[model samples]
Target: MGAGMGMASDQQWLQLALTGLMVALLPLSYAWVKGRRDRYRQLVWLTLFLTFDLILFGGFTRLTDSGLGCPDWPGCYGTANPFLAHANIHAAEALMPSGPVTWAKAWIEMIHRYLAMMVGVLIIALMGLAWFKRRELRQSPWPATALFILVCVQGAFGAWTVTLKLQPVIVTLHLLLGLTLLGSLAWLAARSQPAASHDAAANRLSPWIALGIVLLAVQIALGGWVSTNYAVLACTDFPLCNGQLIPTMDFRHGFTLWRALGKTASGALLSHDALVAIHWTHRVFAVVVIAYLSWLGLRARRSLTLTRPALILLALIALQFASGLSNILLQWPLPIAVAHNGGAAALLVTLVFMLTRSGPDTNQKV
Candidate 1:
């Protein structure tokens, strides 16, 4: 019996190793494509695209109650692939047909894990390339190393997201960290190429642009908090909470980041007022962010270099605002909610790219 058990463990290990390798094919293909074109610059762009997809799919996984579908990290139910967990998932589904741990949910969760591992592999390859081509590249190995560290930290948060039962703080931090990674990657990609030499003139609204970026980031954080806490529907009204301009709110509990997922510090279930507070705060802050970003975009439209990005920013801002309102008026429809999240990420990427290009090519002088 002991020998049989040992053999089974060995087989399981082999299966997981194989799955990890199989998931690496996409990045490997990307590397091959980059090698053929000698366009390492475009590789960064491709990675950015994949990162955005990962973020969206991650939202899908969370929204679908698939976060705990597999109920394990780096593997599904002690196996590397969902096939191995088929029986376990099937059994769970049989027992609780309408509950969270269905086979479909497990598959979704495992697929997400696989995609995440692929992104990690891609980042690893990127760092290696950065180091190999450090002489030719303007950016140093330090940023790549920092990115690697960020991904690792993000992975830890991902693990805690499950282990802690999707505690609001951990999950929200995970989202913020992912966005940070995207922004950093965008900055690196912008720095990798020789800046366009024709337009060396400084953006006159650099200070305002910087301020807009900062404010947008803060609003994203608050939005993440609101989503993680499941406060989207806390306030059903458009301009007010419960038909009042200033409805009753528990800002203390709403802003308390250290509490449990659905409970206050004293361990009681959090009040509806707290949820109202969280949601309303995000709603009110949106007005400030939207106004500033719109103004920034309009200000930037004067410069040819920033005109396209500014317009894109303005369009996305409008789309996000509409989608956000639709969520309240339409009862949080999944499609609109997902689009809203994607729009926020898209806006961030656009802003980052614009900011990176808005400045002069200082490295050319170096």
Candidate 2:
């Protein structure tokens, strides 16, 4: 709700970029020195790793109620970091001690931004390297190029996440885009390596994997919806919601995507039934996801190349179930909630990695 772009000075933006560049140098240096061949691929995988971290940290920022810690995009109180904006943060906190802005929360939010920018810089490097090495590189440069654009769009959504006052739709889309970027990077990383031996079974399972991805994407969206709306505790019990199999729910209001956070489109306060609807839908749909993905993982295990990732997928499914339960049973512990988010990303990465290798060798070329 703060005047996002109008509040931040140009100097703050420059400083933010500088900090990101500094953070990116660590991975750049590592890739440069550690890689003897296919450094591009090395950087891609590195970017993927950091991106996974960024997503988890983003979840942390949200879970801790730090989304509005700085209240404006790309800077804290028109400054690059929390230290420079301490007076403002302190004033806001002092005025409302339980409110969104606090020194610690500001740092958490700003640090999340800094990591995001670092990932952006690395992706820029990837786009540049891919284009520069297009002739000799094993994989196509276009996907890397597309990744750069995707990161920019993700950054936009990141800004909107704050500026739009953490609207559920915007936040959910932001989460989805982050996962999409992770999955794309996973595929690119897989392509940068030598093609594995073709598994007819894995190839045959491609359509099923595609179906699983659709279901997984839907489940993740539902999860994001629940998280953004803070509806996880709407159903504290495992098998029942509000001690009933079918609790009263306001599906119309709950599924209204464009409304403000905790409010309906008409600006009335969101109802308990709406929250229950959000949480319950996610809970019920999760069963379909678990069953389908479990079957997919088991089916994938029959493939020689996909067996390991398939096992990892099954493990992640179990982790999701456990962490998800912990969120409800433990009243949404920070570590468990964040791990639940990270587990989703890991599942997507593993699944996409499997999909990348599932194709025929002829189509495997970058």
Candidate 3:
């Protein structure tokens, strides 16, 4: 809306349409593979799997500081593919050499966009097929239609995440929206699959299990804040923060919800104390998430149907704990850090799977 940002470029519009057609072929191929018996269900499961992979790759893009590799939203340098934008990308890299706009980073950024578009195309096909087979499948296509709409919203935030120059709040919201979409697809897949038999005891604890999910979601938001602000190394130690149990923290500015990328609301540079506050809050919340989710796991494990997801929850929390500790002790190795992001996503989907199976809507065989 600003004078500088202006309207979309002519090249950008044409390139985006070409990119859409390219990614559309992916779903067409996918449907052909699962042409027999409840193929829509197979499509749902496959899309959910790809979405999880996209989230992890998105983490790779962020952690490598390649968010602005192309310096544009959907396309790289006004072109859909890096190969076509080679001249523009090389010029930018030559100007900044070791900066954000490099050839490798451009490839990374463009590939991420391509995968996102592929996921969107698959979701659209899901809506189409679900409606076409509604008579035989005896299921409404509304859920797939809803997913297609959600992917559009997610794509908008993805554009903002780049165009806004990775503003901390905007970037964090973009990551959250991706995870939410992943969970929605997982729930959709679970709905299509036949429900496993659930015993009486597991049915009784659905409310408490739901409560645990909410708590985990809050912890994830705190983790996102710590990440988007680049405050992970504020403490440089696990159990203790900066050699004190409760270091001096600037909660006032640290938790100011609406601020720019690396500055406070008043445009002052973010302070070390504020960074400590954000990091410490995430650290403290992790303990609570681990304990409460484990307890929920124990209760749900008494029933055969809920046992596997509960066990998965326990494993993911353990992985999260180890990876978080490694980030501090090892000075944030890329592999461990990316794994930590995947751990959170796995935990979220596992919970969604459990909830779908336990609810009354999933009690009957497909």
Q: What is the lDDT of residue 31 in candidate 3?
A: 60
lDDT of 1 by residue, 179-265 (tens): 989888887776766665444433556667778879988898898888888899998877767899998999998889888888998
Give the TM-score of each candidate: 0.91, 0.96, 0.94
lDDT of 2 by residue, 1-366 (tens): 456644456668789999999999999999977876878888988999999999999999999999999998878888888898889999999999999999889999999999999999999999999989888875578999899999999999999999999999999999999999999888888877776886898889888888888899999999999999999998989889989999999999999999999999999999999999999999999999999999999988988988999999999999999999999999999999999999999988888888888877625567
Give the winner by lDDT: 1 or 3: 3
Candidate with best TM-score: 2
Q: 132-153, model 3: which lDDT tens digit per residue?
A: 9888878778888889888999
CA-lDDT, candidates in order: 0.81, 0.91, 0.85
Candidate 2: list runs displaced more than 4 Å.
1-8
User: Candidate 3 regions off by >4 Å?
Assistant: 1-11, 23-28, 364-366
**Is candidate 1 or 2 superior in TM-score?**
2
The positional error of residue 225 in candidate 1, measured at the CA in angstroms, is 1.3
Better of 2 and 3 by TM-score: 2
Candidates ranked by TM-score: 2, 3, 1
- Model 1 error, position 117 (Å): 0.5
| TM-score, model 1 to reference | 0.91
Cα lDDT, model 2, residue 133: 86
